[model samples]
Target: MKLRLIIIFVILAVPNAWAGSQSQAEPQHEPAEIIKFAKDVEKYAASKGARAFIIARMGRPEKDLPDGIMFTHTAIAVYSNITLNSGEVLQGYAIHNLYQTAGSPDKSELVVDYPVDFFWGAHELKAGIVIPDTQLQQKLIALIAAGNDQALHNPKYSVIANPFNSQFQNCTEYTLDLINAAIYDTLDIARLKANAAAHFSPQRVNTSRVKLMFGSMLMDDVTTKDHKGKVYTTTFTTIGKYLQKNQLADEFLTLNSKGEIQSL
Candidate 1:
């Protein structure tokens, strides 16, 4: 029952608009399929001579979300040409994502770590990969190096964040902001927000009013606000659409639990 309630909370926590990892003490192992998918991302980037890619996975399903909307999390993966002491060029990758801290519901941290850690605990092994062009990839690398990505983060996480508003942010929003910054003059947050909303508008999901109220009341970060009127939230779907429309993505892939790849 407790688990059910938690799922309920996560599922209904959003309305429309809105809205990482690492290692430590003991080494944690991700599922075999996820690891394989990560490897595939690295290999694909290297093969295309691409500098960066975006990856998202299907987390556990939320009952409150509309059917067929499955992706729950997204992150950016960047490839670096590591020159070893032997002068051999080895490609190394760093994945970045924003995660909420355990101590406080409102506090979140930007995590930079390995690709393997990015897909940990995914409900299914499925993933969406977006490879941006060389110039855009260079811009993405700059953002990661200068910590400009942090500027785009909104600690106030919401299930359905208003893509047009700056008050809240989620993983997808962070990723979108990075892309926007790289593509346009990201120094101005107002322009970036406007561009993002123009390319992609969040979609609304229909749920019981009681569940919506319960979610807003029970969850510290969840709220109806203007979202109830807008009736939509941004997720991987919106992000994918923006990428596709802009012609920014060099390659896109969908991988299943068995590690099969299909062009999305």
Candidate 2:
């Protein structure tokens, strides 16, 4: 009976980390509150004059997340001229994401959304923000503008994907790929992976092996085949560390629901 309960807990809890793009079926907060917070995040980024930056959202409650994992969904947000419903063009930030397909957690698609839409289904109103150095920022903008972001995308999705290979990719890993592509100025994924293996420090997943094994058995997106030893995957915090270590970031901080900024 204890083993059965453990399996059931794994089935229920594991997917929260593995499937970062899954949205809550119902709104957790009021629409007005969500929209206000999203705009606040945008305002903060704009104040920093960020042309392109890394953004993260909390898709699950803080207490439920595993150690070393701060945020769930990470993506790139580029400043752009957006066309609205009434054919009006306005300058704002557009987010690029790797969201798991509805009803297909194992598959993913690249999606571009605005701040309001990006945070609409968030489980928490907090955000993780990282603005790259000016030169790298320009490179990121150019890469996305030139449509190279799609070139680096791998639709083979995994929650705990190995960053040292091309077998599987999660949202944070994809963000890292884009950053490396910008740094190296090449779309060569092989070279990118090699560089990552050499320089990047992925977040180690701190969870029981038994739970992970059962999660792999029960969930399509929770497989550990790509990982050989201890499970390590790219995360928002790790990305910040990489950029800060190499002097690629101008700012790395967290934006709370109260519009306060705290350096990470």
Candidate 3:
């Protein structure tokens, strides 16, 4: 059941979507072989200065009926993110398709098989573990698992849209974004709320910027000049405004009534 709602994705499997460590040193692999070769390549990549490679699935329970055929399938989803030496980043995912076929042959029975496995070329066939920081990725995984369905709807936290269908757009990325938003937003807020004597304005227009731990996307803080070409109020919404390119994209532009600048 591919629901149309935004799913905070911890992981997903998408068409041709993958992120792998770029290693001229690592052994070469065919596109179709990536999934099956995950374990081996991950180890090899780790040895060759690649990041961590992980796999996760999503689905429901299997039900057995009177039929002799074994029919069991879950909404399968997978994700992979890796970092390179120069600090480049790649990420991708796909949704698992589980189903069965009736009357496969003359025999009176059904067969359990995936009719299709969603993947895309632009998304990479796999992801790397980001080898240097497994602990950080694991911590993020824990945070996402802790969030319930209700938590996904909150604006304060980056909404995890449908990862499987949203092209690996899981809540995991949103949560990561929020974490960054908090860091950058808080730093900016500190400057905005400083006393007049401690006031330090941005030297250039729209120079204040925010970045992510992985450098996936750069969400710019709202900034402009006054009629006199002076940097005026640099409003900050909260410390953590949830960093989605669209949702809280304009986050740092606004301020709460309290004027303390909320921190996520």
Top candidate on lDDT is 2
Each prediction's Cα lDDT score? 0.67, 0.88, 0.23
Estimate the TM-score of every prediction: 0.80, 0.96, 0.23
Select the stronger candidate by TM-score from 2 and 3.
2
- Ranking of predictions according to lDDT: 2, 1, 3
Assess candidate 2 and give its TM-score to the true structure.
0.96
User: What's the residue-level lDDT of 102 in candidate 2?
Assistant: 82
| Alpha carbon deviation, residue 2, candidate 3 (Å) | 39
Judged by whole-model lDDT over C-alpha atoms, candidate 2 comes out at 0.88
Estimate the Cα RMSD of every predicted model relative to the unseen true structure. Answer: 4.7, 1.5, 21.8
Question: Model 3: per-residue lDDT, tens digit, 1-264?
Answer: 353221212122111011110111132335545344443433343344422222221111112111211111112122445354789975533222211112211111111111123211112232212121344334434433453212322222111122112112222322223233232333232232242114222112121122111112211111121113332221111111222222423222211212232212
RMSD of 3: 21.8
Q: What residue runs in model 3 are displaced by over 4 Å at the alpha carbon?
A: 1-31, 36-135, 148-175, 178-264
- Candidate 2 displacement at residue 85 in angstroms: 1.5
TM-score of 3: 0.23
**Model 1 ranges with Cα > 4 A deviation:** 1-34, 61-65, 81-90, 226-228
